[model samples]
Target: MLQNWKKIMLLAIPSLISFATATLTGTVSLIMVGDLGFVVIAVVGVTNIIMYNAFAIFSGIGHTVNYLVAQNYGAGDMKKGIERTYLAFYMCIIFALLIALVGWTMSSELLRWIGGPKSGNLVNVGTEYLEIRFYAMSFGIISFAFHGFLRGIGSTTLSMVIALISNLIMIFLVYALTFGTLGFPNLGLRGTGLAILIGEAIQVAICAYVYFFVLNKRFATRILVRIKWPEFRLLAFESGKLGMQEFSLSLSMFIFTVFVARLGERALAANEIALNVMSFGFMPAFAFGATATILVGQYVGQGKAILGRRAGTDTAILGTIFLILLGTAEFFFAEQIARIYSNDVQVYELAAYLIKISAFLQIFDGLLNFFAGGLRGLGDTTFLLFISLAVSWLLFVPLSYLFIFVLGWGSLGAWLALYTFLAVFGLAVTFRFYRTDWSAVKLREASPH
Candidate 1:
């Protein structure tokens, strides 16, 4: 158990750092653009929610690839692992193009629907940002796929390094382009979008180098030379199912955000601040969740069902500990943290309240993330898909409506609904984890056609 804990932490901490860096990048954006006022902040927040919903579809491919690669590698099938990576890469390109085309064509309409004409400049700003950012989907998706591949092979440190460097470049470019510093144009929100694009493109380049030259040399694996149609179809089908799960979750959040937006710009901006701050505390759980997935998948692949279960248990323990400590800090410093994002007194006060709410829910949040990853790693995605859809759509959305609309609880009411959803979802997944025989599940056997 101790050794498993050590191993999980070794992989997970770097993953945590990578995820934290990504979260901080967005925090910096909010901080830098906070001066643009509540409307602009709200616009960025809405755009981010939409972007993530779209990206979640392709990100599912990365998660699926991670499970496949880790299982194959653990089973001493290096060639199969390499093949899975190539298939994921190809699928990523196709999906990226499709997602971009759809986003580009519908950005204006979507923003208008969310923000309405009364949103004034917010709609136009968000639309333009989405249109520009959609063009970077290919690069971002490719980078994510490579990150998943590396994580599966126990090279999370490489992914961390790439994420760190790429995010640093984004921060610098955002400052320069937003303020017309370093001989760049003062493009404001558009500059923020451009910086994200260039940064993702650089990450893609770095990942390509690592995948082709570094990893190839280290693992003695060859690049994509052939397509395996059967395996390709299976990967696509599994990823698509997982993608639908992600899409459902994102859609729920998007709907929730739309409700928040209806409360006005201040409410939306405050919600964004609260979410970002909550992300910091969530990072440890997120990392541990990814750790659970990799370790459990690999152990199950090696036919050690008990070891796979042990890995998940150990990860949940560690994640709970980390989140408890972080949540304590968040509870005490909620106001200060909120102040970092905006000078608006109302926004900060509301953000602080939401942060306190989030602080109390951290443990349940950790449980949900850790177990969800464990289930995914065990090739139990169907259950996760069903449960997530049920909770998000049936329970969460309705409760949110009742709290915010019917009862007039506003943001606090919306958050209370979120807390209830996470608590229920966490318990459900945890029960499933203990009760189910995940060891008998085989990815290849479960493959569609």
Candidate 2:
């Protein structure tokens, strides 16, 4: 029991650090742009929401690589593990390229439609930032493959190092370019996008180097010399199912943001700041969830369902405790945190209120991630897909719309609707985790025709 706890924390902490650093990069970027006025902040925030949903959908597909690699590694099939990783990596690139192409051509129009006519400067700046950032999606998706593989094989420290080095450098580049300092062009929002592109390229280079040098040799994990159509189809089909689950959730939130957009630019800016603060709780919860997926998947591969359940439960508990503490801080220090993002009095006060509301739901938020990870380990993505679609479309979308548009509650209405959606979704996921029989859950065989 003690050993399991140690194992989980050791693997999870580094992942936590990796995500924490990534979130920090976002927070700092928002703060830096906060000085440019609220419109620019809204531009960046809206761009992120679009890209974030895109990433979540594809990263869901990428994460199936983790599911595959962990199971294969536990079953002592290193060759098969690498095969799936290679497949996922290629698939991510192909899918991301399509998205990039669409974003390059259509992002401006999309922003105009979402923000409505009054969006003015936001549409122009957002389109510029989003297009350049879209160019980096392939690189980021490739890194997702690497992280998925690393987490699968329990090599999380390497993942941490990569994210830390790349994003830290990204910060420097964005800062330099945003302000035209350090010999970099001051492109404002455009500079931030350019910096992210460069940062992603650096990240991909590191992933490829480490993969070819260290991991490939250590595990003798071979790459694809030829495409096996049957294997590709199987991998894509399974991952696509998972991607749909991810897409449904992201799509809902994307619409929710559109409703927020209806509230005006300054309100959007405050929401962005509040979200950055929320990431403090969200990222750690995500780390524990990732840890649960890896650990639970490993135990499942070993035919130890009870052990998998225990790992999932323990990690959820620990994550909940950490979030409760963080939530308290968010509630208490809400004003200070808001000040970190904006000096505008209205923006800061609204952001502080949003942060306080976010604190109330941290417990449910933690449970959501951990249990969802457990389900992923059990190869239960299809179930998740159905649940997400049902809740997101049927309950979340209408309620939020009603609250924001009809009730005249503004941002408060959006947050209120969000609180209800998450609580229901989180509880639903937790219930499924407990009631299901793990023995009945089947994973794919490593060696496929």
Candidate 3:
């Protein structure tokens, strides 16, 4: 058990660091934009929320590459594995371009709707910032392809390296270009967009080079493989299901925020601060979940149902214990955590209170991620989708409406709604995993031409 836990941690840590790096860069970018004044900050913040939610949805589709590749590679079908990688890569590019086009054309209109009729400069500035940012997603999704391939093959180190490279460059470029320093042009908000575009382009070049190099040296697979569009139909369909499921998470957050926003600016701001505090642990739970996905997926592909089952069960145990420790730290240091984000007495006090509440979320969140990860390996996403839709909107949303508006619980009520949601949703996911036999599951592979 100790050795198994060690194995899981070894795989999990690099992914965790990689996630943390990406998030840290985003935080730094937000802070840099904040320096330009509050209006700029607000526009950028709203744009980020929209951008994040969209990316979350589409990236869910891209993860089809990871799921398909892991199973095929584990079953010793390298050709099919490589085939899926390319097909998914092509699919993501098409989707990225489609997203870019739609976002670009509708940028002004979307911002207008979001900001309302009276939103003048806010909508205009956001439209410009958001349009430019959409172009970056093309390269970002391309890198996701490389990441999925590497992760599917159980090599996570290079993904971390690529993440560091892209995000570190983004940090440097966003700083230089935003401030007119280091001979880089100061285009202000536009600079942030250009920086992301350049960083992701660099990411694509390096990721492409590394993927092929690894392919030749490690896997010894043919460098050139062909894909049939017809064969990719099933992959795309299944991936779209996953995309909707992932999108629901962001939708839930937005809905939850709306409910909180009604309580006024203080509640909203405090809620944001509390979320930032919560994120310190969220990334790790996600990392552990991804690790479980890779391991369990691989084992199931290899026809070792019993081993896969045990691995997932043990992973959930180990992940819960670690999160419990992290939650304890959050509980003890809630005040310090809230203070890091804001110093407003009422704001920080409310935020600190929310952080204490969020401490419970760490455990529930870990369970959701871990079990969900295991289920992803089983290609059980359709079932998970139904659960996300049913529990998130039906239970959580209404509960928030009841607690906040009717009971006048304010933000406290909303947090309780979220707390209730996570517990039920997390346990529901856990139950699905335990009750099912996943070993018999394997995805159909496309014939490499």
lDDT values, one for every candidate? 0.86, 0.85, 0.77
Clashing pairs in 3: none
**Considering lDDT, which of the candidate structures 1 and 2 is the better prediction for this target?**
1
For residues 223-299, what per-residue lDDT tens digits would candidate 1 score against the true structure?
A: 54487678887788779888888888889889999898889889999999999889887798789999988988888
Q: Please, what is the TM-score per model? A: 0.97, 0.97, 0.90
lDDT of 1: 0.86
Clashes of 1: 0
Q: With candidate 1 superimposed using the best TM-score fit, by how many Å does residue 119's alpha carbon deviate from the native?
A: 2.8
**lDDT at 28, model 2:** 88
lDDT digits (tens) for residues 60-133 of candidate 2:
76679887777777777777778777788778878878878977798888788779867778776678888888
| lDDT per residue as tens, model 3, 172-225 | 999998888988888898898888889988999998888777566766544565
Residue 245, candidate 3: C-alpha displacement in angstroms: 0.8
User: Could you tally the backbone clashes for each prediction?
Assistant: 0, 0, 0
Error of 3 at 56 (Å): 2.5
- Report model 2's TM-score to 2 decimal places: 0.97
Q: Per-residue lDDT for 56 in model 3?
A: 71
Off by over 4 Å in 1: 443-449
lDDT of 3: 0.77
